[model samples]
Target: MKYRRVKPWLVAGGCLLMSACSLAANLNYRALLVGVSGYPGLDAKLQLEGPRNDVTRMRGVLLQRGVPAQNIAVLADGVPGAELPTRANILGQLDRLASTAKPNDYIVLHMAGHGSQQPVSPGSPFARDEPDGLFEIFLPRDVGAWQNLPGGKGGAVQNAIFDHEIRAAVDRMTATGAFVWGIFDSCHSATLVRSAGGSEEVRMRQVSPQDLGVPATAMDRATPRAPAGTVATAATAVAPSSGAGSVAANRGGSAFFYAAQTSEPTPEMRLPAGHPKRTSHGLFSFVMMQALEGGAGMSYRQLSQYVLTRYGGMNETRVTPLFSGTALDSAVMGQDAATVRQWKLTDAKELTVGAGALADLEEGAVLAILPTPISGLSEAIGYVQVSRAELATARIEPVDYAGIPKKTDTELKVGTVGRLVQQAMKFSLSVGVDLQQCTRPCAFDAPLTRLRNAKPGEGVAGAQVQWVAPGQAADVRLTAIGDRLWLMPPTLGGQQACTLRPMALKAACDDQMERSLVSITLGSLASPGNAAQTIGRALHAASRAANLMRIASALASSPTNGQVKTSVAITSKGGRRTAYVAGQVPRLEDGDKLLVTLENTGRVSVDVTALYLDSRYGITAMFPRGLGASNRLESAASDSFELEIHDDTLGLERLAVIAVEAEKQSERADFSYLAQPSLPSETVTRGGNEADGNALFRDAGFAEYATRGGRPAAVSARTGMQVFSWQVVR
Candidate 1:
């Protein structure tokens, strides 16, 4: 069944006349913020402590961004003097905003509360189209009062706002050529919250269908169905537009940012009373409000990352935020096209961005330089790397100008202003595993498990092995010795000619008899394949997940940037020897001293922190106490400092050095909190400092940074920061 789209309500003749007169006026900025923390007449289990506070914080951010007080509307539950956020009041306000908006106007609709899903009644208008037999809904303050009403009637659904309703309102606004931004800080699932360690009391804001009078039979009958004209797949969903047109097709387009994925839960937290920033807020709202401070010239993508990095830093991994919109790269907070200005090129190669450490600029970030008068059609002149970054400005060195038009007179010169564009970075690994020798009756399964269970400095941990094969995409794990990689026990079923390639000439290998590199294909194992191949793929998936977890942990703990010169010294009994070559991976014995020389060109005080991820995938803080001295380096005119590595470090280890400018002398407490060591094998540590660090670096913001191996951007302050990664093998 095709549902008819709702039409916008007609304004009175006088109102239309007034609108026409104001068509040429400055673009109006309007916002409708609905935050519900109290559910009257409902179970206390449904109560929240964040929504009321979320609205106040958001309103403050908007006001600070230059939005007039009269242009914003607020409806909150349990807040005196504020409009009540009942179903009727919320829907009425949406309609009013849609009908009154004009071309070039900006409308922001932010909803912070619980979201629920209910079964669509049989024969209901939405049933045939909603293959899942459910309606996504926002629960208003009076939702409890309407729970007892019979299904299939308007009155029964009156208290909850449906997704279609929101889509319709957004559509109407977009039809008038206005831009719309919708932020929903709620989720439909309760299982999406990551429980704090040792705390069973944590809860997500969600309600079941039964709690809202949805019959089990109705929900049971709501079986999944393949929609007409579309192939059904586990990864694909086919549904009618919830209400708005495609993000790109609508005038000026619209964007929707949800605090959590559709299946995940959004969380609210109460900070300790003496916390400096806030007391209670949805985690999303808290991070978002903090992101807005000193975030004047950020694109929607940067804004999203600001929230993501901080959210991840909090050690909350149950739900990832989602963003969908046409203007993802556009400035946030509704800055008009005329108001968008480009950063000026101070030197032939350097583009000076007024934003620095506070804006999240890190060394080695790549940014696209776009021609002035920026728009969707603006052409990029070239790309540049952030060679030097500071608190308020960064020096960008030109990487290339191949994108510039050859016939044009444009030259790399001072005072040329251009917009900078950042691209998202993704990491992936490619390797081939030899499977030629394995036959039908191979009996090597025991050895495979032994390889899998190997510890750091033993067996195959941290070995690089290559494979040569043709036409096969199967995954396999192999152990390397000398120049050849041996296939681990339990040869895969498929027959293919494969050979292991020798290690690259410059690459160094350990003295161990057996070294291995694991390879796994990412896809379904249901296809008829050998048991060994399927098992190998599963192992690969698990390893990949573990690697990502480690990456997140490293990001939460590591500092951003500081310049350093490093060398490895082998203090063997034969004699004290130095392996002091810049940029070379050095091999070492059991008792080697890793010498690091630090330099601070900037005047700001900095903290030097180093972390090592060992061959066994274990992480250890190697600097500060780990290395037996304070790693904090103060600013000096001729500053030169040295750090000595401990003797216990082993295996193929990756060392990351981060230097961050001090925010305040007291902020050292925050670093100490993050530096507290976790179990060597533990991938994630839950603590308040992680969340606090998330907020700190997110507020600092980073440049459009990418690394060759897909390492995550190191977290750091925007000013006077640098990061160096080195490998030391023992």
Candidate 2:
């Protein structure tokens, strides 16, 4: 049952999986585990550790999750009575699953083996489907070397399962209304350039396309191509295959979890890290099994995060796994974690992220850039600020340039993920003025000169802040009328008009309440104000407000989320208490109060901060109310906070708990500075400040709220937030 040197624990492709349950009569749970560790056609250098042990591990996890022994199927080279994992048998099992699976049945398909790619000839019918003209494939035990087609149509690898064909088979099962989970512990190829290190004996699950007969030139031209030889090293066979769970996915009734991105190779390393006889297994599979064995219900998003955390904890930072599905929030049988929206970084020079409007990223928003997903914010190469934003994509430019080496940006490989530090308002306001007061000989030179010479101090709106000469992409146009400076919401010289409905208050509007674009007067310059102060102050407030909003939107999106427990209870005026319904919004009447309990469930101690954000533009730090107080909750400890309901502050109100892993007892990460007095709903003035200047200005520049020195210091552990929001209706 055991062998030495974990070979490429390859499968025909990724498997389709289903969770086991006690209700066998109502829901049928089935699985097909194909693990191949041998490739006679390839050199001994390419053989992987036998996956017999891998299959056993998988089988054990299923049994723990309640799958019946009779329902599980196995196809491997070494397992007795198991059918050989030839391409035919793998497809046959899929066909059986599609044909026999009922509407309510759930299935799990797992494949472990070597994977590579082959080029599709331009003349092949499937050539157009592959952007790089290469078909990602998983080699079966019987897979042969790639050979050119007789007619020169293209090249083909015998016994390799193409990824698209696997997708089609899964589609059939899903169409039957059965939920399918495709869990592959292998990567498509090694497109990543990894010099990152870890301690465990690592075995890669990728075979180079070149070894499979892919033309060297075609491999070079591929969008995400592998090098000459794979990063794989032959290892002796050690194991076998592996879970139950409500993971949501993009395709209806299906979800896919890849051990590595299309660009990287996943590893088969000794799992459970320090086990006395730690067996070698695909790192992704073992960690995932650990999550599923916990028996908590999770969404696909949650499962993806749990696996990622294991990688980080184990110091395996090279491979970046991936997940996709529409209902990532739906519950499945497993654990959950925070959701950080990361996009693939395609270009370092162009500084582009593959996310935009859909992800709510705005121009000028800053992001923490990491060399790998496992890198924490403290390990960021530097920070990037968005330069342009479109519907589904955005472009980024670097800041904190000194954080990285001179040519580091150019060397950053593709697929790096960018993390948001704070949000920028949808569109920054650019001031354009002719300033009739100054001659061409002086066209708005006085105000422009002041702004140009301003320092990059705290609360600066944006570095890209522009004061135009007359035309261009201007958000606000200022004119000198009499002794006063008048601000007009118009496109100077009929150029780019302000896209925001209410140029100055767009960022302040909570909803789609139509507020007309309004202009403002900087008061008479002769009295007390100057063009520089009025324009400059407004810019800072707008920028700050945007940052606060973006941070608020992502308060609970950290990987550290789900580590802490948050529970809510409501107390009636009569002293009776009731558990808060999961998704039911409470309509709080007078005297109704909500109590929140926080429990530290993660590995390390964490400092917790309870924050409240109301319908109006207000953020209040509710816990550790004093500046010097600490809210550190050690592992297994709990903390509680009570919130009073306000009749006037009606609409959607939120209670969020932020927990940052403590690196040292004295370390603290306080965001209390984010707390600001709520702005009155009636104010829509320019310079949208979230502070108590009597009335916080809208659209841009906010009056300084507090002395600004307290931002959290970088820590080795992650910062996590857990939020509970509900409607406050009369």
Candidate 3:
């Protein structure tokens, strides 16, 4: 056979693959799973009935599929809600497991529990005017809810987690070039029905315990009615006798697969207390176990077909899997030969970690936390915990080698905030392209590769690139430039190959392009071979909680009196992605502490907002010094804006945000925006579509606040009254 000339880049992962090929048995692959039930507060209402079993069974399936016994790690399988683990603790566990992960290794997560939602505002064309939807999962033994949730009076029951939190975790893992997968079996009603550009009809999700035999009185009295046109999305399929249990929301992504449809029920059966078999698992689990035990060598599609064909249309319970793949018409199929072979490792290793075992390691050992020491030249350093056997064989000292550190092409500065805004751009690009070596510039004349092709935002980070047409040639170069890892063709005609058009305000535009979403940028803060859940949670809480004022102020100003007339009134709304509600009570002041109760309504733990008023605005107040929740700076200025945010609660819990004002009266005007306090102007990074203009007002009376930090609080000749505009994520 004639040999075809191939470029070095074309070999792709050739070195890694060759090494793996040398061994008869595939390399080890691992996973860590944690699920909790028996909550004290909502335990009687939103109990976890299915996910625990599903996750437990999944452990067995992975082991049978060839995952090594030592490779899999699990924590808190049967922990109750009151005893659920802390966010930091869970993250610490995942970090330890990540130590063994290698580039291209697959990491999977399976969660089962409860979910919550926020009330929908009026005029939300896409929703039925119900509560804003929030999705979340449980932390084993977690005693309280997130501070941001509703009705979280410091002692309320904690709920589950949502897509944002999970995506944050996935972003951290995939950045290491490791394939990350998550299987969430909680109730997902909080997810918007109209996202992903799908038809509104798709949002008509099935009802869960609400439809079961549980009395209406047993349901949350706070459950808001769906808007006029969309009243059917409630979970209504459960038998009346069935009580409220945990559920998951439906969020799609190229890197994720939902085992059930948006409108279908994920069922769980109560086994006889002393039954010989398992105690409680849902229909999905039942079918999934059968497929794995058979070892039929079936693809995802074939296996799904087997399950559906065998159990479709069965009386009280039925199962469906919503897969994202190339089959278009079939919802399955289309695995490239190469990609299939890469994922085949999962089939070769027998998952050995039991569901009840704790990882022998901790997070500090497995993941490196990226340190922002200087501008652009940022690097990551971390360590992975390992058994003495692996450490000795890997050859390097375990502690030192465990830390994975890399220096990008850019200089990185320490002590800078807004890193999340800077990282979002990186994440966006990472999700749309493959980052392998290329020797030449991609030909402009060649067919363009659209990075936005796959399920645009599945809440997971990673790109899936397939040749649009066979034999398409668009060889390109991927390199590290500044902090940016550039994906472009090699030098073309002695100049950079790709022509990137910068937006107006050149400096701002450059920063925007180079920024990765806070959820995904893991340099300095992450460790290799391990998941970085801690950094992810901290960043997520900061990014989202920081926006509470902007959203709250936007709604507070929309009414005629510029005040929240009721305790909480749903007001302006746009699409399914965001909603604004107004709640006007006694005006808050700087140093005047206020306590607000919230709850985590989603499946994943949520980051909610609690606003405090600062009477003045000043440079110190604008840039108050603080090192997390414990050591925050108090501004004496009369008009500065400030708020405190926390993460850990899963259900009904409470926390407070104290907004301190500048010490001077003149500064008071600088801290207020609308009748309510708006978010700090610098929060969202004022830009073309992402700017929140309403935030430009320092106080209700001022024309506008400065866009970049440290500018005068008052509008200047060079600055307009409004420096930013509100444009929600579409």
Candidate 4:
């Protein structure tokens, strides 16, 4: 026999794990996890350690989701009882599944490993079929080095699993009326970079074509030009086998989740940054699992939003994750569960939940004790704050609030569950220094020490600063590349410093207007006298930006989010309001005016507050000018607020409107007190008691202000906030 076909019942865990059904059990759910870590054919620097972790965690997540251990087949290096992720085993399993799939069978294929680009293989049918003259590939453990083809006209890697091959197998499965969801956590657009910057542990999931013998010009021809925030002449890593991911998205029976766009890099780092037990794992994998576990009952699009928003909140504008598929509305199965992760309410001595670090819940995160898994926010008997959190369980304590004073242990019905409400927020920022270029006497040492040792009580310290090794999980990195220093958002690895190019300074003060649009260089900040202040100002900007996103992300989960009816628009030059739409970027002209209307759609009257997040990381409170009918829109009534836009900074900006249930007609939830201004420059430094939790504090902002002693304010879950992003153009 020329080939061996894996029997689903024998090797792939088909009917062996279950009794034979009357006729092919309905929805024969199956999964194939391919995680490649060892690459004998590549350089040692190219080897990785995260794929093993990714596979292990993924298996556990699937098990929790109810996928029988036998139905799931794992192919990873170093994982016991699993076959090696060689090209032959991967294809054999795919063929095995495709050949046996029945109509409506749900299948999942997750590939986590190193990906690269190669010229079309010689003597292969795909040779002339590849219009781009290259195949985007996922490297198997047995993948071979690139070698010269027969005519020397091109080159290709031996044993590299090509895109078209993946498409063919997936197509066969889809043709059988099965639905496939493909997830790729690896990137192929590798811009080879110097390893001198950042911590040494973090690794990008890309292997540059240049690393092979491909010439730069040929490599350029092999891939198209990259869009914004990416280097030119890159392969289509974003597509992850356009045939594969798109099959799930465009085909009638599939969906795909991409870790990054074409030409952009994705990083793998130690997860749960502050956790001592944290080990190497792909950030995308960890993030994906956290989102999936949080609520496996949602649609594909909803799941995508959670990953995107949470990622943006942590790493602004670094890389983007894309989800495409016609099956967006399809519900994911944690084995038929469409509800948030929940634990049955009990009379145990301590309230312990089955969810822990795996669900991304931290110690300070808050949860709602609901009457049932599908219970609404109003049905919450009381709230609980996570007291102790571990991998699989957490201890909860009832929190005191005005409406419900204490934890209600008796009034709950049988089968009640604890629902996730809000994740705990830590207002500290971590910064890392990349000194790959210079020696000990370098100029960055002094400033690094100062910022690394920065305090967190008040003023600039309000945004706490943490120093970490380069390449470790960090919010920002100060990298010294030879003679030039660069300020960059966290990059995946070495060459990703490509994003470190000159960044146009945010719209500055009138005195700095001449320099407003000018691109700033980090090299100028390397001098001794200026290093400290420069680092301080930069950190200040980063802190404010991160906090603003925190407000947008955390409060976005307000139990009342979708329940509150609101409209956001801006009056244009012609005096007509251009209503802002979701999923599209809105733009505002210099003279444009923002118009917001709030309708009390819920059971009780709501206090409305509007905030503006600027490109400079400054936040301004726009509503509740102070105490009146306008302050609290009546339960059945509506109100409007407007703010004029001027010729200020122009870039990405956000608008957040929050409505919190107000039991009384007199008291207002003045969240405007959380308003924080841009550093050393513009914004309102106005009203509200600083020491009080209601207002934004001097340095301790949203997280610290809302949760004074690990307990959040009472109105937290009762509140609904919606944030919008628009481009402020001239």
> What TM-scores do the predictions have?
0.46, 0.44, 0.31, 0.73
Candidate 4: global Cα-lDDT?
Answer: 0.62
Off by over 4 Å in 2: 1-25, 194-200, 221-252, 333-730
Ranking by TM-score: 4, 1, 2, 3
Lowest summed lDDT across 10 adjacent residues in model 1 is found at: 231-240
lDDT of 4 by residue, 1-730 (tens): 0112222112122221111111123455689999998998888888889998898888876665445688789999999999999999999999998898776677888989988777554455754445545567888999887766667666767788887778778777877777778888887554323233366556778777765555555555444422333332222332224443544433436767777654456777877766666788888888888765554345575566556556656744445566765566556541233334456554466667776776667686666777655567798888777787777677777776437777654554435677665566656677777776644456567656765665554333345677775457677666654444455556533223332111121222222222112112335324433455555655665676676565555654455665566777878877987775443345566888877777777677777887776655567888776534356776678777787776566545666777778875456676666566543331111221123242235344355335545343323567666766665655
Candidate 4's error at 323, in angstroms? 0.7
After the best TM-score superposition of candidate 1, give how far the Cα of residue 629 lies from its true spot, in angstroms. 29
* C-alpha lDDT (0 to 100) for residue 1 of candidate 1: 9
Worst 10 residues of 3 by lDDT: 418-427
Decide which is better by TM-score, 2 or 4.
4
**How far out, in Å, is residue 432 in model 1?**
44
lDDT of every model, 2 decimals = 0.47, 0.55, 0.28, 0.62
lDDT of 3 by residue, 1-730 (tens): 0112222112222122111111112223557665554445434444555555556667755653445556556554463331233455566665654444455455666655543332222233423222322122333445443332245321112333323344445544544545545555444442211111011111112223222222232233323342333322222211011112111111111134454433333444432111223255544445545444432233454444344322211211112344332222211111112110110011113211111101111111122223421212144333222111120011111234322443221221221111110000000111112222223342211112322232432211221122222211111222323322332211111112111111122453233222211112223332321122222122222222222222222121111111101112112222112121111011111122221223222232211123232211111122122312211122221122223221111111111222222233222212212222221211111121222334323222221322233221211211101001111111
List the candidate 1 regions with Cα displacement exceeding 4 Å: 1-26, 127-131, 145-158, 191-202, 226-249, 272-278, 335-730
True-vs-predicted CA distance for residue 158, candidate 3, Å: 4.5
Q: Put down candidate 2 lDDT per residue, 331-422, tens digits, no spaces.
A: 55222222344555877457688766433465666677777655677777677777777644688776654355333556555566677666
RMSD (Cα, Å) for all candidates, in order, is: 23.1, 21.2, 25.9, 8.9
Off by over 4 Å in 3: 1-28, 45-53, 79-86, 93-101, 119-140, 143-159, 190-255, 259-265, 270-278, 316-320, 325-730
Question: Candidate 2 vs candidate 4: which has greater lDDT?
Answer: 4
